[model samples]
Every structure is written in C-alpha cells, then in structure tokens.
Target: MPSVRVVSLVPSLTEAVAVTAPGTLVGATDWCTHPADLDAVRVGGTKNPDVPAIVALAPDLVIANEEENRAPDIAALRAAGVDVLVTEVRGLDQAFRELERVLDACGAERRPGWLVAAEAAWRNLGAPSAGATRHAGRLRAAVPIWRRPWMVLGRDTFAGDLLARLGVDNAYAGHAERYPRVPVEELRAAGLDLVVLPDEPYRFTRDDGPEAFPETLPAALVSGRHLTWYGPSLAEAPEVLGAALRAVYR
Candidate 1:
C-alpha cells in the first residue's frame, strides 16, 4: 500500500524507499544514484531541489533528512499541500528507527529483510570491551570527508560511532564540533595511527588522498556509501567496512 506518488530529497532515503517500495518513487534528487536501475524523475539536488518541479509531480509524500535538505524547501513543499516527512538519524540505532518510520509512512507494514539483517550484523559485533583498544591493536583514526578545507569527523558522528564500534578510535572524538576543520599539517602532526578516507563528499582516491599523508602512517581508503550511507547498504556495511579497514587500517 505504498503512496501513489513520492519524492525523495535525500539520496540515502531515496535508496531506502526505492528499494523497499520501488514504484512509489516518482521523483528524486539528481544525487540519488543507488539501485542502478532506479526509474524516478530527476529533480535537481539535495541542497537546491527544484520545488516547482517537485510540486509538479503531485507526489502524495516527500522524504527528506534534517541535515541533507534545507528548511526552506521543506516549508515550501508543506505549504503547497505536499506531505513531507523529515528524518533525523544521528546514530546506527536511530538510523534503523528512522528508516522504519519512513517506510511505515509509505504504507509498508513489514520491515524489509535487509533492515533486520543489517541490525543483526551490527548487533553481532557485541559491545566494545572496557579496555579493547589499549594494546598494539589500538587504532587512532582520522576520517576526512572533504580535504579542501580539511574537515575531519569529530564528536558524535555516525561514521565516527561506527569506527568506534569497529575498535577504531576517532582522533577528534572529543572535539566540540562534529566536523572540525583542521590544517593538513596539524592533522599530519596529530599523532594519528591511521587515516580512514572515504571516496565521497569529495571522492578521495588512492592516488589523490593517500599521498597527503606521511608514508609511515597507514590510510584506509574505503567506500563513502558503505561508511556513511545508512540504508540497504547497511546490510553489507559492517563486513565491507571491516574488510576495507582491515586491509589498510593496520
């Protein structure tokens, strides 16, 4: 019983809805590029969505996220009589709850199998030990999404939380800002044991980002979607991220 027509302003949510209930998505942002075979109309991007075009779709509902979509756009859509459900996902558990809520809103009664599988995968990781990262296997990590201004994961971020669950301590975990901007030289001198780079938000690659770090310091270049995306990708994220990190996080 999915909505007759729906639009997704966020890429992650787009993948979630598109996969969970395929034909419901009538329009999506240009950045929604998952499911390789998604057949939704393109309606601009996450930051600057085409409100008029979205309204033209006459969607019964529009899905969005607090951090990814602008407030003004949501308000405009609401004013136009479109039902917009905005999500706030700050952690792994929260992500699950939010995804379920979005699906329920879309008239989905049963949670998708992937959601259950993803939860089971992470739950199997168990709890972090009292002194898990004390010895040689201890890892002090810096995750940079964008390098132009040198922004690194800080404070209570989903990526940082996942890294911590994987036994990798975020170097800026105690920083006041969630995403702190630090100079490259400072990052290099921050005594980091490893730098976990993702191929998104800036697409850091082996040749492009690894060279920025010292030869002695190891860097794990992993998939940004797997590391940051919280959707159907979650089912494989634990294994995928673990394998990627293990490959280079030594």
Candidate 2:
C-alpha cells in the first residue's frame, strides 16, 4: 500500500473520506464540516473547487462525487494528471460500496464489523407498522426542497424513497422530476396529513412561511441532508428517521 495525500471536493465525501483516513486528507471544501477541524482548508464549495490551490496541495488522489461536483472541474483535475476517484451513490447500498472503495484506496482493509453494525442498525429499526394503525386514511405529504416555484421531493428521489420506507406516501409521487414545483393552491387542495420542511436547499423553519399551508397540515422541519443524502451516514438515518415518522404518524 502506498501513502497517498488526498483532496476531497464534495462535502459529504469529504466527511466520509476524512473519517475513513483522517491524516491523508490534505484539502477539503468549505461545506465539509462534520469533523469541524476541516474549516482550516481552502475551499471553493463542492461545485467549484479551486484548481490552482488543489494543484498546490499536491495531493496524490482527489476524491469527489459525480452528483455534487461539476464535470469541468473533474475534467481539469484529470487533465492535470492527478488521480481522481468519483463516486455516484443514489441509495444506501451504493453508499456502502463507495465507502468500501474509499477504504481500499486509503490502504485500509474493509471491515465486516462496520458493515454488520450498519446492517443491524438498519434491521433493528424494523418497518413502519404505525402507519397501518394510525394512518388508515390517505397519507398526504408535501416535501418541500425549495421555495418560490415551491419544489418538492418527488418519486424515485432519496427523500421520496425514505418517505416510502417510513410508510408515509409522497403526495407528489407522480411528478416527473425528482424534485418538482407545485402551486400553492394545489398544496391546499391536496389535503395533506403532514408537510415536511427540510433544513437545507430551502431552510424552512417553524417560523418560516409553512403556515400558509392551511392549519390542517401538520408541519415538521427535518434535517434535509439526512433524509435526502445517502452515504456512510445513511446507516444511521433509518433509526433517527424512523423515530421521526413514528412520532408524526402515531
């Protein structure tokens, strides 16, 4: 195994890679704040990494994500003859595989212990039986991702998928885009059971404008990254999110 210095371009991968191999991380983006000490690094955010600064870091490997990083930045890094590992994880299984790849890259052997723990945590959460008892009627929901045009988590998206796992059906499940916009009147007419306001991409809070949704729809502000972003952190989310769903549905 070779000793390799690494730069992380995506915030989530930055956090994951740092945990996987701490000392090997030479540069990380501004948004990668899980470890907190990562604030010392020069950053240009996830989509825009400083190429010259990255080159000056002289890292042996650069880790990035296909969804979070821009194609041009990856191309520039590759053209510079720098070794780059790009990950594309749409779900939990893909996330675990990505973590394994990072561990292998960092000269660390994959630990079955970690996988078993994660799997057990997921299985221990069980399924959402509360929905059957408490939610006999239509389970209407509004998962707002952004304001203005009012985008929401649609079918096949990570957030939508989590809602299904919790037995809370997405009201916008039929929308074409992963996140789609809905009119204010449509939200009112939908007769929602709950409206989930996420903390990111929109930053909806209790004091925020969600009150406009007619008092019938109960709203809860949740961690957007936890519900939407799948990675090593996902292994921990089922327990936390399951609790949230049980609280809301039950």
Candidate 3:
C-alpha cells in the first residue's frame, strides 16, 4: 500500500476523514476538531486554505469538499501536482458514497459489520410520528442562518431536505439560493410555527434576545449541523431532532 499523507481543506471532511483514517492526516484546517490530535497545525479557514503552508506540508493527497471549498484554491492545489479528492454530498446516499470514496482513497476498505450495524440502527429509528401528525398545524419555519441581512435555509438545500424529513415544510422553499436573505416582515407574513435559531452559522442562543420575534411566536435554538448536514452525524440526529420536535409539540 502507498503511504499517503493527507491535507484536509474542508472542515466536515476534515473531521470525517480524521476519524476514518487518523494516521494518513498530515495537516488539517482549524475547524477539524474531532480527532483532537490534528489541532496542532497552523489554522486555515474552510473557504481559504494556506496554500504555501500546505505545499510545505508536501502531502500526497489533499481532501476537500466541493461546496465548502472554493474552486480556485482547489485548482491551484491541482496545478501544484497535489492529488486532491473533492467530495460533494447533497443527500444521505451521496454522503455515504463520499465516505466510501474517502476510505478507498485512503486505502481503507469498508467494515461490513460496521455498515450493517449503522444500517440497522438507521432502519430501526423511524421518522417521528408526532411530527408527521403535527405537520398540518406545524408552523412554516424560518431557519435564520445569518442576521444582518437575515439569511435563511432555502429550498433544494440539505437543511430543506432535513426539514422535509422532520415533517416540517420550509417556508422559504420558493426562494432561489440555498441560503437567502429575507426581510423580517416577510417572515412575519409567512406565518411560521417556529423560528429556529441555529447554534451555528449565526450562533443564536436562548439569552440572545428573542424580543425580535412577535410575542405570539415560539422560537428554539437548535443544532445547525444536526439539522443541516447529514453524514455519520445523522445517525444521531433522528433521535435528537425527534425529541426536539416532540418537546415543541408538548
């Protein structure tokens, strides 16, 4: 087997790959914290990598995600003759496929027992019945990701897919971008059942002043990655999100 040193440029894959193949990781971005030991590397943001620093690392492979990483930087890395594996996962199936690809690239084959276990767990944890029943009465949710311009999760996004899976309809499904900015008044008119403040992308907290919302509306701060990105993390989300939704109903 070829000994390959990998520099991870995307945060999610940085975390995922580190878990799948810790020994192969030579360098990683600041946000890759799952494995803990790789935190010693010089910090690099997900969108912008430290090119010279990466070159200095002289990795055999560079891992990145198509959506999270900028194309020009990937192009630059390729121009420097660095082998790059770019993953684009829009859904659960795509996510599993990308994981498989990463494992294969790192010379790690699938552990059939683990796959079977994960599959069994996923199958056993069915969708929330309460959420489905409450769907009709469910408030169209405005998942504000950013504040200044009021960006939200739009239709055709991973978050939107999760919303659908959770039995709640995304109010911004008609919008264009995956995350778009909308006026506060527009949100009020949309008649939302809940205003979900995610813990990331904007880091909305309970003490962060819910006075911005009308007194009649209910709001809850939720785990952004759990509601949005579905990967290995998703194995934990069905239970977590179901509990959250059940709480909202109760």
Q: Pick the TM-score winner.
A: 1
Model 2's alpha-carbon lDDT is 0.72
Candidate 1 vs 3: which has more TM-score: 1
Model 1, which residues run further than 4 Å from truth?
A: 126-137
Superposed by TM-score, candidate 1 places the C-alpha of residue 91 at a distance from the truth, in angstroms, of 0.6
| C-alpha lDDT (0 to 100) for residue 130 of candidate 3 | 37
Candidate 1: what lDDT?
Answer: 0.86
Sequence-dependent TM-score of model 2: 0.86
Q: Least accurate stretch of 10 residues (summed lDDT) in model 1? A: 126-135
Deviation (Å) of 145 in candidate 2: 1.3
What ranking of all candidate models by TM-score puts the best one first?
1, 3, 2
Please list the residue runs of candidate 2 whose C-alpha ends up more than 4 Å from where it truly belongs after superposition. Answer: 112-115, 129-133, 136-140
lDDT of 1 at 55: 96
* lDDT scores of the candidates, listed in order: 0.86, 0.72, 0.70
Question: Per-residue lDDT for 165-219 in model 3, tens only?
Answer: 6666678887777788888878777878777777776878777625578877777
Q: How many clashes show up per model?
A: 0, 0, 1
C-alpha RMSD for every candidate = 2.4, 2.7, 2.6
